[model samples]
Target: MAADTTPPALQDFLTWRLHRLAKLTDRQSSDAYTQVFALGVGEARCLAAIGQFAPLSVKDLAAQANLDKAQASRAAQMLVDRELVLKSASETDARGVVLTLTRSGRPLWKRVMRLIEQRNADIFGCLTKAEQRQLEAVFDRLIAHADARPQGSSPATP
Candidate 1:
């Protein structure tokens, strides 16, 4: 049989679909964070990273949150201004400061964790446990492939 020549629809593209889902989820989570905790998405990312892994430096938090250093620093400072995080001089590294959730931030972090769990359930609860595991494995492989690409090589460009 002759090959079909029809172009794939935009919605049928995996990359486009993945990006659509990401944007939708990000918007939903961002709205909830802003309404409930007065945190923007960037700030929420930083806060969540620090809350999950205390004593992290701005550099480490940036890496964990997949944000640039400047954005991470700004988010960290915002959290500091709100008293949600305590930035203290690192005992091991005098040049660096460690970030940890404040007494008030702990409860907020718990709330954020609950929100995240609920969001995951809402998005993926339809998938069976086996299907979820398969999806996770595919995601891991995609992440590894993306990570292995050379910097500045745009996936969208030839």
Candidate 2:
């Protein structure tokens, strides 16, 4: 038989579907953050990460916030400029700095966290509790598998 010649639809790709879902959720989250806190998603993410994992270096902040180093650095600087975050030189790493929320930032941090919790609830509300649990487990496994794979590796053959 001749090889198949049909073009694949976008929906046929799992990665595309996941990207579309991420875009939808990210847009919603960005709008919510802007409306309630006048903050960008990057800033909010940085604030949440710093609040939850204080004394983090810029490198650690990038990892915790799921952001690249440049984005984390810019957000950290903005927070520092707003007096919401204090950046101090790290004692352990001479070239690195640690980030911590200021007293005023603490209240904002709480608000951000509450907003995040609400958003998560709203987004996943369509799913039953058991389905949500199953989805979470599936996501965890997928993330672990992705992490275990080497970057730029070829996809496994069927």
Candidate 3:
């Protein structure tokens, strides 16, 4: 048995796993929405965020998406151009706009959500309910850890 102490191995593992999960989910959704739209994951994500929590400002959307505000603003503009989303000048603030999923967006929202639910169910079916809960608890712990860290630091690396 050779030395097995690898520094930052856990950190590297966590980063790889996180990115892998994102890629897998995006691939599935890419297949799900294959022919109906011309949106990339970023665009679809912005739409999904607005679809779930509409009437939010671009700033709020950025916070929710963990995206740059300028990027969110541009994504929202593209969505608007496609008529998949609607944005209105804010009544409360002169420098803000509020966004909502449009009528044409309703079906797309439903479709994406259905795909998400199905994939979630499929993934969860591999474990017992208790195991599922444990997995979720582990994820919650990591989330709390990330929440507590300084903006750009990772626990295992820091």
Candidate 4:
């Protein structure tokens, strides 16, 4: 289906939401930088993706995290050096490697999840039931639009 390009209001709303999310993400990353690996935003994202999808290969992990192969590979190595993740050669493909969290990272992962959950609750807690419903509907619509768009195209143009 063709996107409804005529809805200027929808475009505006999406743009505003994107900016708001960016700001929120920046704040979170900066606040946690000293505590974490002084990692930039992308590194934090890589860590979360690894936590969520452990035992994934570098290529798969990059795709899951919306990162490029180089970035993901670098992050994976960094995580291994930090003793947060483990990397082992894939049994199925000798050239491929899979990454997973190490034993020591369990507590840190849990702490990060709790902190993020609290922030999410704080951000959306003020919305009423109806508002929450509307927000979900809007988010769904945005995702549909995104899915319909071509790959390699970003919503936030640089």
Model 1 segments more than 4 A misplaced: 1-8, 91-94, 153-158
lDDT to native, each model = 0.91, 0.96, 0.82, 0.77
Report the C-alpha lDDT of model 2 over 1-158, residue by residue, as the tens digit: 99998999989899999999889999999999999998899999999999999999999999999999999999999999998999999999999899999998999999999999999999899999999999999999999999999989988898
Question: Which parts of model 4 are misplaced by more than 4 Å?
Answer: 1-13, 36-39, 152-158
TM-score-superior candidate, 2 or 4: 2
User: Weakest 10 consecutive residues, lDDT, candidate 2?
Assistant: 149-158
Question: Per-residue lDDT of 19-120 in model 4, one digit per residue for the tens?
Answer: 888688668755774465466555566677778888889898888777899988887788788888888989999899988888886666676666667666
lDDT of 4 at 9: 67
Residue lDDT tens for model 1, 7-48 = 989999998999999999999989988998889989988888
TM-score of model 3 relative to the true fold? 0.76
* TM-score of each prediction: 0.83, 0.93, 0.76, 0.72
Colliding pairs, model 4: none
**Which regions of candidate 3 are displaced past 4 Å?**
1-12, 152-158
Top-scoring candidate (TM-score): 2
Candidate 2 Cα misplacement greater than 4 A, ranges = 156-158
Query: In model 1, how large is the Cα lDDT of residue 74?
Result: 99
Residues 56-110 of candidate 3: C-alpha lDDT, one tens digit per residue: 8999999776679988999889889989889999999998999999999878877
Candidate 1: lDDT over CA atoms? 0.91
